[model samples]
Target chain A: MRKILLSIAVFGLMSVSAAAQADPGDFIEPIMPPQSINLGMVDLGKKLYFDPRLSKSGFISCNSCHNLSMGGTDNLPTSIGDKWNQGPINAPTVLNSSLNLAQFWDGRAADLKAQAGGPIANPGEMGFTHTLAIGVLESIPAYVREFKQVFGKDKIDIDQVTLAIAEFEKTLVTPNSRFDEYLLGKKDALSADEMAGYQLFEESGCVACHNGAAIGGNSFQKMGVVEPYKTKSSADGRVAVTGKDADRFNFKVPTLRNVEMTYPYFHDGAANTLPEAVDTMARVQLGKKFTREENTKIVAFLKTLTGDQPNFTLPILPPSSDTTPRPTPFSK
Target chain B: MRKILLSIAVFGLMSVSAAAQADPGDFIEPIMPPQSINLGMVDLGKKLYFDPRLSKSGFISCNSCHNLSMGGTDNLPTSIGDKWNQGPINAPTVLNSSLNLAQFWDGRAADLKAQAGGPIANPGEMGFTHTLAIGVLESIPAYVREFKQVFGKDKIDIDQVTLAIAEFEKTLVTPNSRFDEYLLGKKDALSADEMAGYQLFEESGCVACHNGAAIGGNSFQKMGVVEPYKTKSSADGRVAVTGKDADRFNFKVPTLRNVEMTYPYFHDGAANTLPEAVDTMARVQLGKKFTREENTKIVAFLKTLTGDQPNFTLPILPPSSDTTPRPTPFSK
Candidate 1:
């Protein structure tokens, strides 16, 4: 009975320490549940998300890049665009993307709605104009009826399409990770090694840039803070958006949720594994060399951040009408 | 009470007619539910179906061409493949494809498993070899575990992968179309025009090749039997597979189930609309020209083939492990 009381006392102290460590506005927080959803708009968005008819090839959709089945990323070093064109940067995960301060690697688009339009009109991406995309939707009788019901308008527009897609995207938050459970007073949720790794992560100052409900995506940070990040690709990062030479290698911090699934990490997707990524960050960002064991511990902690993935039925799109223009996939 | 008795008499007569039409070894029947599924194999296959890692680029999957969301087809005249290489023929719908006597436009593959292997290795398709694919699977711990559990094997193999994919494909049958309800004695399921079209369809020789629970896919037939098919493409159809002059211009009859959505019809995908395809098939295959009204009625009946699509949660695939080969999508 005395031994049992002693163990209980020790456990109570550990729980108090964890609670004390949970400082408000720290580097992490639980993912909030999605706010009010418009099921009609969401339904329309689901169809649009899967409808590749929006592209010139009629073969690529929002799901092609931000695939829900694969951690909202194509899992390629970079994306394959229209006619197998290689995109400039690594495609970021769209999971919990709404929590980001801005959208895209360079923070070019302000929100998911604005970011949604870039791919459809990009010459190397979906390779179609908003007018052509709208025209395709306009020709589909079922789509027209759906758009009418969702937008309260007789006609379809890119704004309505993007808005609906954004609405759906907002609901893709990943909550209830092991870390979140630990934060919510579940002391045994994480293993001792994982807890140790979390402490090292905090002590090493990695949380300065990666802290938030998203674990990142709240601000822009220089890729090579302490050293240069070498790559053959000549992307100017945020410089293209800001026209500032000083901002040459700065990029919006990508969310770490489901980081285990979103492989080939960073702007260039240079780091292929979580351990490699951690070692690289330690060397380049913190300017510190970690022992092999420390790297493993950090990776273990990172794995606990993987939350539940989004679950939804694959939406079935309506068939094109007689008036719908045929896709010219092979044409120049 | 007298009106109810008269209606009952009429309904009883209609039931008798439907029962009499259900002949043994008939050209068509209502689609049956999927026969005994090994759900574990299906679950693994579902992940593989959405896994782009099967491709050399890691951007294309079985779902890329045979998209479940869009009438089981990519809706392209021909699929855009590796490095943007255009495929020679239109992709066939995978929906209800297991019913076919053989797979592919030329009937080259014996079954779905054989067909699934072709695209992964095809230079213009997924652009990967079975050896490399197996190596990748072997490196992934989760996939290795799954393969062991499903196949009762110690190591991952290409055969097990294909078997699992085929097992999943078997469950893709679309049942309960409006036409099936009509066939099941719900006489009012189809509109008057649709019924008239069905009558014309049976009276004409369209039922000869385009029949069965799949509404086709029973055997190989000449693309243009009574008349020669015109095309800019030089593909020799089944001749390439059989190495016979007699098989020239011969191709497998594709399913007319969901024919309304599988647009750009034929092996060449020359017809862009159902009405246009009806007119062309009438002129070429049956060697009979139909009036505008007759063509409209036939198209209307074809619309009733759109049935309940496969409904399930979008599967989340296991992440690639450290030893897994990184996809060199931009390289040759």
Candidate 2:
């Protein structure tokens, strides 16, 4: 009888310990750094990402709009594309984008690899066809050799280029944010005001849409759930992708991992400051209003989401060979 | 007499050794890597060099034209500047530019520091005045802090900005070329044909002006020294700086250290291939023509001048605060 009682006591203690370990608010997960990466593919992808020769103008690369230096964004209201063409929408930050359920404002591309090919061929962006981009790569002997080594293929293709670029981008996740530390059992990671703001963030229904490892990229949500959002931008949002009227104004939630670095928020880039964006979201998305102090505290808490930026050596591109095609930047 | 005879023998051997060491083609010096650099200034300058906010368009940085990935040059015939404006002359390579007697083809700016400021304020270049550039820098707290730490000044100025940029550029020397190896007593570094080409180069008097660590940046010479060369470029060359009719076609001789990489040779960038550039230089500068075989050999020798490229980590710029002035990229 005593042995049976002791076994029951031990099982009770084990259950409590397990519950405690799993219940760290249970809403958000800490973003951990990638465990491993293929170094060769990452190196090759990095070169391709910075190589502007992929564009028709030879001035726009993948890094042009999704600049890694500026929190994986251009920090412009909209991107400047080929021949200085104005981009249709605000460029989404590439940092932590791999965490997203789908890529782009409308969730058009299913993954980062698919998204990689869009900007290169888009008439409003890089302004180059897949065939031309492939031709440029095949002409460069160094790129051909690298492609052969990385993919173990004799012929280069657009699929391999995008795949390599996506591999590099997958390593661009920003980990070790203060919020992440707080979630990982660091009690003093947040100040009193920040903690209070987080409490308000959860209680006021902000957690409903923003609950995930990326804090928001786990699902699609309506921009204006409780009210209409007014903007001059002609973007139809998810309606264009889904071909359904029910999906109008619906877009994939962007990751809030490095929101402080990515300013001019929302699909139209209508809000220029954190306070302004918070106020707008509270009013339109939740039909709730916050005081000045509340807004300031929330903004302070959001700042803690900024994580360690990716550090990497600048790539030294191989010189173009004699037979390599020269870039015609000004010649349409 | 025995002691005096021993001294004479020692001195004779020492003299022979000294001659052998010093007379390794004394006309040209080997470019050595910088021994010391100010890390703080280099870090600050690298961020500033890549920052497009200094430009009115917010789309162009120093790297736009002097791209380190492509032999410190844009590899374009002429640079595409503010609002896609065509630059008057081809952008020069920044590698080993510290060895040049002066900066720019006309030697308008005496040094890199002065050259650094010209582009920012030039109407046709970055399209931003010094005052506006300073304002942009001052508005950013991170930049202001960095400037203070680097220069020990409370107020950030254009002078300090230029100084930091120049300090970073000073470290962009490419060293340890195959030619430098041969000069340093490595006999097998050069092929038989390359050695023959070097001999012909000396005999043809091409070394008259092209004799320095940078090969050709030691002096200014007339473009058509022996024969008038034709070009569609309207640049008046050094006449703009000297205000002399005699200096009409005189321009600073460009560095030939990385001639293989900095192709589309000359101020106008007319020659697309190394052989074509060699043919033109031999015909117009030296009044000597080389056979196809000789040209090929010389081209092979020139290829040996490509040195180890600069390798450094890419800078991660600080995020702009709310009070910081936003860039007006398309507000011209």
Candidate 3:
């Protein structure tokens, strides 16, 4: 009887160890830096990203809205576009966006490549046509040479441009956050309050929608599940893409990786502070309100999501040739 | 008689060599890179230079008009400023601006430090007061820490801000141009046509006002020394500073270093191409006309002034805190 009991106890211990391997935080995963990337494509893409010549005004670049310096966001309520036109929705943070299942708030574009082309031609954004943008690149001999080398194509096209930009975007993942370390089996990474906040976050069912490697980007959730969110913004989220009333106010869950830096949260950017955003999510998404102390602790836990940012040299753009088209920023 | 002839020949050769030492092209001096800069102040200034938060709109930065990527100048006819406001005068290149005797086309500000503060308060430019700009920096703990480290000051002010920016600008000097190599004793650096162009430039007295290490930033010259220059631009130039009739239309001669990149020349930015600018300067400034071939040669010679641009990694700015004053980009 003693020998039989020892065998059963050993088997149970083995089963517990196996379960621990798969249940490392169960709902959360640590972000890892990209291992392999084409340096030539990334270099070309970086130049294109910072090149304001892509815009009709020659003033705005990809960095204008998704500024890498300031947590991959413009930090505005909404982005200011070409000719100072105000955008309808808040510009999403570009940091760790590669982990997202789909790009943009509405998940309209399939991936970063498809999403890259949207803003360049958007009437309210860059306000430039693909043909005009290509013409600008074609006029510059240096850009032509680089495109030929990177894409191995004689003809420069929008496909190649977006491809290069997407490749560069893939490298923008932020890793080594305190929360990520904790998930990776470092128990001492988080403070007592932060650990308590994590427990509350998991128990409150916030993990249902906000889960996976990005902590939120894997799913589409309704903005106001329990209560209708009131805002001045007219954006109908996924309804514009799905052509269905059921998808109204449904938006892609934003990644919480750099949530501390990406403030004025949500589709309309109604919540100016993390506390306000946290309180709103609790009341509206989960229909559960926590005390001020709990809210403060949760915010403290969120602050641990701030990670190392992408570091790169500012690219020096080639000069425009005599034949290059001039930007008519003032002309209609 | 043979001994005296030999002595005379030796004396002539020695005099010619001594003259050549003084004259190394006689008028223009090669620009040398700045040595021994404060790296801490420069790093801080680089962030300030690129930070759009300095502007009320949070859209325009010092880089917006004086773009380092595109030859330290926007290459625009005139600058598009806050709220897309059109600037009256052409924005000058910040490259090698430290070598200039004074700052601005009208020499309104004594140096770069003084010039740095002008655009921030200009109603049509950055459109932010010094106090408000200071508030933006003071509110961010990272900037505050950096300021304290660099300046050893508990309280930050506009003076230190401008000083830091000026220090960064001082390091923007572009050295090692082909022409600079020629000046530095590499005689074969210039082609035959380029040499001819240089000779023509000197013979035409174009070097009279444009003589210095910066090639043109040594003195103030009238825009049209020989004839009235026609322009729709209402900028009265140095008259704004001197408040004298003689100073009307008298502007600072801009540095010709990297002139190939800094295009759309003159205060009004009416001359679109280098050839056009050359022809206009010859006609109005020097009372002479050059043939198309000569103009092309001069343009080729001018291209040799293109130098090694400033290379540096893009700075990662710190996130704004909850108490930090938010940018009012859209609010009037």
TM-score winner? 1
Tell me which of candidates 1 and 2 scores higher on DockQ.
Answer: 1
TM-score of each: 0.93, 0.91, 0.91
Model 2 CA deviation exceeding 4 Å by range:
A1-25, B1-24
Q: Candidate 1: lDDT of A49?
A: 83
Q: Which ten residues in a row have the lowest lDDT in candidate 3 chain A?
A: A1-10
- Candidate 2 chain B lDDT trough over 10 residues, lowest sum: B1-10
lDDT per residue for candidate 2 within B152-256, as digits (tens), equals 989999999998898899999999999999988899999999987776665565655666788878677789877898999998899999899978988888888
Which 10 consecutive positions of candidate 3 chain B have the poorest summed lDDT? B1-10
**Candidate 3 global CA lDDT score:** 0.84
User: Which lDDT tens digits does candidate 1 get at residues A1-332?
Assistant: 22222322332332323433655234478897888988898889888888888888888899898888888998887898898888888899999999999999999999999999999999899999999999999999999999999989988999999999998898889999898888777889999999888888776766666767998898777787887888866777889899999778889878988999888899888789999999988887778887999888988999998888988888888889989998888787
Cα distance off (Å), candidate 2, residue A185 = 2.0
Correct interface contacts retained, every candidate: 0.90, 0.63, 0.67
CAPRI tier of model 3 = medium
* Predicted complex 1: CAPRI docking category: medium
Which of the predicted structures, 1 or 3, would earn the higher DockQ when compared with the native?
A: 1
What lDDT does the true structure give each of the candidates?
0.84, 0.83, 0.84
What is the lDDT for A115 in model 1?
Answer: 93
lDDT of candidate 3 over B178-216, digit per residue (tens): 999999999999999998777676556565666578888
lDDT by residue (B1-332, candidate 1, tens digit) is 22212322332332323423544125468888898999999999999988888989988899999998888898888888888888999999999999998999999999999999999999899999999999888888888899999989998888898999999999999899999888888889999999888877766657666777888887677777777889977778889998999789888989999898788899988889999899999888777899999999989999998888989898988888988998777798
